[model samples]
Target: MATAKTEKLSASLEDYLEAIYNLSVDGSVARSKNIAQALEVSRASVTGALRILAEKQLVNYKPYGYITLTKQGCIEAQRVVRKHNIIEKFFVDVLGVEHTVAQKAACEAEHAFGPQIVEKLLCFIEFVNSYNKNGYDLHDEFRSFFRKHGSIAAGDSN
Candidate 1:
């Protein structure tokens, strides 16, 4: 379930929150310059986003001070990060997408999918993992199929 705070956040703000959460994972708070560097946005843009996040009670921010996530912010950031990871894993592990391409795609897709879809994707990844563990190798099979047929269509046969 999305919190009101998270629901109200724009994708850009969510990105900022995720960046902060990742930065702070090293046991240090995030600075504005670091956030800017992470997101590839300008320092002014980072300041503006930080101010908005602070107003929403999503971050502990003071000008020129290290920033940290509030409890709610951490929850929301975790949600975003989870979505990104699930999508990236699906793309890379299941679809055989390049890691860099999957990373970029996941960044865009993370904000678009809701909890239900994300959960389903995670479950699907688990199912694929199980299949691989059981010696099924769905990923390899799909790659071979794609190489032969170029694409799957209705009534396609092995």
Candidate 2:
């Protein structure tokens, strides 16, 4: 689990931080409207969120200007973003969920699921991928088998 200070982050704040970090990766700064568009929030909401992040020492925000993450904020955002990606991979590879749905669901789950669980999920993903070259999907015929044998169906993992 992350420390209590990290838990202080709301999902929205994390999302904004991630957006800026990603944009700033290839550029010098991030515009607020771009962050808003990426997160599907309005410009006003982006401003308000930036205000909160500035108070938390996560960002440097200037009205009608640009935003940039502090060094500590960049590290934190990278960790959070990694957790989100890990969860997305878990949903897609382990649960056989679709990519787009997994992205959204992972966004919601990353905050609640601790890094230890995410690490376990990463290992599970690698274990599943070990059989990839053999051309298999874990979920093929999954529904029928589950219906016939109950949820704990045979061959559920493979």
Cα TM-score per model: 0.87, 0.75
How many clashes in each candidate?
0, 0
Model 1: residues >4 Å from true position, as ranges?
Answer: 1-7, 132-134, 151-158
Model 2 misplacement above 4 A: 1-7, 131-158
**Clashing residue pairs, backbone N/CA/C < 3 A, model 2:** none
Superposed by TM-score, candidate 1 places the C-alpha of residue 5 at a distance from the truth, in angstroms, of: 4.6
lDDT for each of the candidates?
0.87, 0.79
lDDT per residue, candidate 1, 12-129, as tens digits? 9889999999999988878888989999999999999989998888998888776889888999999999999999999999887778888988999999999899999999999877
Distance from true position, residue 119, model 1, in Å? 0.5
* Tens-place lDDT digits, model 2, residues 1-158: 43224446877788888888888888667888788888898989989998888877788777776688887789889988899988898887666666887888888888898778888988877876664546765555444564676665436332
Question: Best-fitting candidate, measured by TM-score?
Answer: 1
